[model samples]
Every structure is written in structure tokens, then in C-alpha cells.
Target: MKKLILPILLTICVIAISCQQKEKQNSIPKMVNSDGSYETVPLEKDTLVLKLIQNSVRNVKKIENAKEVVNENLQKVKNLVVEACTTGDKPNIVLMHEFPLTGYLYGGRKDKVQMALQIPGEETSELCALAKQYDTYIIFGSYAIDPEWPDHILSLTTVIGRDGEILKKIWKPRNIKRFYSSFEITTTTVESVREKFIEKYGIEEELPVLRTEYGNIALSTVQLDPFIFSAFTMKGAEIILRTSTLFFESDIIYTAMANNVYSAMANIPADSPYGGNSMVVAPSGKVMARLDKTTEGVLEAKIPIAKFRENRKLPQYAIELTKDIFKQYQEEIPANHLDMPKEKLPQNGKEMKVLLDSLSTWLNQ
Candidate 1:
């Protein structure tokens, strides 16, 4: 009876979320987008453990054998996965921080493109092997390139499913580019190439929610963007998985509480002045498990998914009330500014700043 009811409830939950989106649309969503959500297989068990890797950051700019370094980083990750998954209770999901393989390379678009790895290339093949070996989901953020979007460097969080399949490729939603005075983030994101992205992948892919057997997980690299995070939750994300190079502890906690979803942030653990803590937070904004700042390790946490979903539903933000203000609001710099020809793309942070200034509505005004 319990088994039967759980399946029914899962179906109802998916419908409830899909129906809410359908209510807003006049026509049915395309087959590519599915019934307004990218659905996955049913839950395998009630309890799920997540292991967040707070690993060391190593930039490959100076390394001569960058290819070897990529494999070396992967080997380190393999060891970590073997260490964590084999000992004690195995984790259902293993998460890694931003730039684990190639790390942060300084350059213009050409250099960045040269440094980035292809998503389905030799590297992800190795990641798929691990996911298949352990029968778990393996997710990590990397600097990637796509043959479809030639010469463009991408900040992508890739999800590998249980059967060694590339489940979803989550592009960094938007970069906090204007904040820094000296330079700009040159990575191509959803906002950077909004028109082209929408034309190719559809709008739903902009803030995609991956419905998985473990839970409704949304992969992201966006930070300090309340609108982006809330929108994901409203799209039915039960758990938000994030990768970061920096820390804003308040940003993680507040977003979880306000959005009403479990949030886990995996950050780089380095012996430096800029080390941030990797943590998992509850909907109540309580820290469930965390690694000490600058520590190299896996921060493990358990989620009782079945119990958490008993009365859970998608969050309903006051969208109608604030829709008018949002419509009126204008951002300082216009998007698609970076969506230029490959040769014309800004090469470095300084060059990006110069290009952005000319395209900035605020500065020009």
C-alpha cells in the first residue's frame, strides 16, 4: 500500500508542478521542452546522500602539459569518489566545485577557448565511466566548449546520470559582470547570448529544472542573483545544486529560505585568503553539513526526500504583484553585448570592460 501510494504521489507532484506552468501558457509546450518540464525516472529510495567536493584549485595557464593536468585533476576526482563512495554509506550524488580540471585561466576569448574542454569529449567520457561504475549521478562545473557554438568558451555544470548518459548541460545563467571595476567576466552565458541561446535551445532551457530519480534538481553556477534562484524554484526545483569559486554565505542561506528548497554550494578549498566553505542547507536555512573554510574534503549530507515531500509543492512567489516593477526596471548594461563574432569577442577582462563600457546604457546615458 505504501509503495503504491508513493508512486501515485510522485505522479501527482509532477502534474501539480506541470499544471501550474501550463496555466500560464495558451498552447502546450513543444516535445523538446516536454510538458513544461524535463521529467526523469521515478525515485529509487527515500533517503539520499550528497557528497560535495571542496577540492584544491589549480590554474593551468602556467602548466606546459595542460592536457595531462586535465587528466591528473580527473584522476584526483576519481580517487576522491572512490574514497567517499566505498567507505561508510555511499553517496547518491557526488558534486564538485567550479573549474576542477582546467581551473581559472587568464586570457581573452581565444585563450579561454583554447583552454576549455569539449563537453562530450574525452573528459566527460571519463566522468560517465565513474557514474556508471557507482550507479550514481556525478555533477561538476567546468570551462567547456561546444562544437555547435564554435569558438565560444562556456561555464557549464554537467550532469551525468546513473547509466553514464549526459543528462543535462547547465549553462551559467548570468555572470555578475558589472560589479568589478578593473575587469569583466568574459565567459559566455545564457544572458550573454540570449537571442541565439533561445533560438537554439528554447527559453525553458534558460532556467532548466532536471527532474531526477533522486529529486527535482536544478544545476547552476549563478550566485547572488535572487531573481534567477527564485525563478528556478518556481519552475519546480526541489534541490538547487551550485558550484562557486567564491563565497557569500548569506546568499546561499537566504536563497534557500526564500525559495523554499534544499540548496548545496560546493566551493574551492584552497590554502589562501579567499577560501570559502562548502555547505548544504535546509529549506529553513539551517546548515545541515559543512566543511571548514579552506579545507580539502567531501562535505557529506543526507536528505530524507520522501519525508520532505509529504506536503511540499512548488513555491509561489508574488509574481503578479511585482511583474509591473520588473517590467519597468532596466539593467545597467544590455545583454547580448558579448554575443558578437568569434574574432570580435573580447579577449581579456580589461578588453571586456572596454567593450562593455561602450555598450553600457548607464555609462552612455
Candidate 2:
């Protein structure tokens, strides 16, 4: 009888432990699967005017009146938001170019980190208030610093809803490093800090699609990356909101047409070197509204979002056909290359390239 009692108690303990483990697993956010179908997205209105703002960033680093310069830039964004909401055909969403708050500064990690702002900080709060007043969604890109991730600068796209609350904070998916001969982006990206990022935010947050009454939106500053955008579409993204310092107009057309989704790009003004050509496009590669040239202004277009979402289905990827090839191919650089000790972090673009090269399987091969 004594032996039987001991075995029964042990069995009960095992069952309790298993239940706890299952609960923890269930607590995780639903993993976005391309192979699965999601519920139809809802819309607040039938037509929405998407205003893509072509503006310039105001650099305030190493200046005597940094606070004033930052305030002026913030005010510029607020003015644009007010104008878009009050303009002839008021916009449902206002988009801005990357670095509109703190423009790109040519410097090391430390210098740029100093210029990065915190999400939900003072600047975003002001934008949120404007969003509430205008009843319009506001989205923009900025270089941000987070206390959770020390010594790392982040490229971010913040989405504000009509309720004046931050709906989503989208991080740049990945940065293109191979194109430049002597330089590479030194900021923290999903690809750069993959392991730690997933650990903290979960894999679902890596390629999150912000589902709002306006539309199922996905925002990023990454350009020339079809795979990343395609993944977002598969995860039920109906619209792609892109922000960038410079213009890559052709890629926008390609992404929209191929994915069969509405796409918009907001680039800095022509006054800034290599800037301009901000535009909005439809799925059929039709240009909705475009800047004739690189200039500072707003490009607006009306999208029949309700009609567009009626029969929309997830992108039909030929995954089974290409599975073997994808599995066999070796990526140039493995992820988590920059997930090192803070003291060992790369300081600039050149150093970043060296670190990536050393970790490249192909380079070593």
C-alpha cells in the first residue's frame, strides 16, 4: 500500500507539470503562418486617402541649439499632419519619410545612438495627440534608442492610431549590406539581432502586420527586399507602408504589382542629396499619386480599401516547389552576427562589414 501511494503521487506531479508547460506555450502570440488562412480584415470606411509626405530630416547632432532644431523638425511633422488632415481630400493615413526627426548623420555607432529617440517618448506623444485630433493614422520612420537593448541604435517605423495611441512599432526587417563596397548599416535590425530579438519580442513580432480599421498594414524602411515584403503579404498584409531616406521608386512598383497589394513610399525631399520620387501605387503597377521630381511636399491618393479587400487572399507562394532549393542554399551571412557583448560591438559601417564577413559561411568556405 505504501509503494502504491508513492507511485500515485509521482504521477499526479507529472501531470501538473505538463499542464503548466502547456499554459506557457499557449501564452505565446499566435505565430503568423503563410500556409494558413486568416479572417477577413475589417475597414472603418470604404475609401481612404493615403497621404505620403515627401519631407527632409533636420540633423541636430553636435549643434549648439540641438533642442530648438529637434523642436522645429517635430513641428514640421505636426504641420504636415495638420495639413494632410485639413486638406481638400483629407487623408486617412499620413506617412513620412525615414529620419524625418533625426536625419542620417555620418558617424560611428556612438554618434548616431546619441541622435536616436525613444519610442513613446515626447515626440511620439505629440504626434499621437495630433492623430487623435485629426482622426487619422500617422506613420513614420526614425532612428531610435531603447533602454532594453543597450548600446544599439534601432531603425523604427511607428504607427499611431486614431485613438492617439501607438498601434505598432515596426523595426526595420533587414539592412542591405552587400551592395556597398566599403560601408554597411551599423544599426540593430531583426536580422542583425535575430536571436535576442525573438527571445524578447517573440517571432510573431519580427514580421508583424498592423491590423487596423483603415487596412491591414505592414511598415518598414527596408528597400529592395522582395522576400521580406512577400512574407508580410502572406501574413495578411493588404498595404505596405515604406519609409526611406533615399528613393528606390522602382522597387515600390515591383513589390506592389507582384504582391497584388497597395504600396506607398515616402522619401526625403530632393533638396537632400539622392532624395525625392515619393509615390503611391496600386497592385496592378498603376501609379496613383507621384511626385514629378524629388521635392518637399505631400502626394495623396484615394484607395477603395473595402472593395480591394473583398476577395483578397494570401499570396500564393510556390513554397513546396522551392522548398528543397531554399533549404540547400547557404545564406551569405547567418543571423545573430551582431549579438555579441556590448564591448565587442562594431562602431561603424566598415567594422560592421568586417564582422559580417568573418561570420559568413560562403566567405569562410
Candidate 1 off by > 4 Å: 1-41, 271-274
The lDDT per prediction is 0.83, 0.84
- Mind giving the per-residue lDDT tens digits that candidate 2 earns over 1-365? 99799899999999999999999788876645544565455677999889988877678666455557678899988888787888779788999989888777557787677767889899899999999998888998988889998889899999988899998888888898798999778888999889799889888889998777888888999988999999888878888989987867789999998888899999887754456878889999998988855567778899999999876677677889999999999989888888988889999989988998888898898
Model 2 pairs whose backbones collide: none
TM-score of each: 0.87, 0.88
True lDDT of residue 322, candidate 1: 91
Q: Which candidate wins on lDDT?
A: 2
Superposed Cα deviation of residue 129, candidate 2 (Å): 1.3
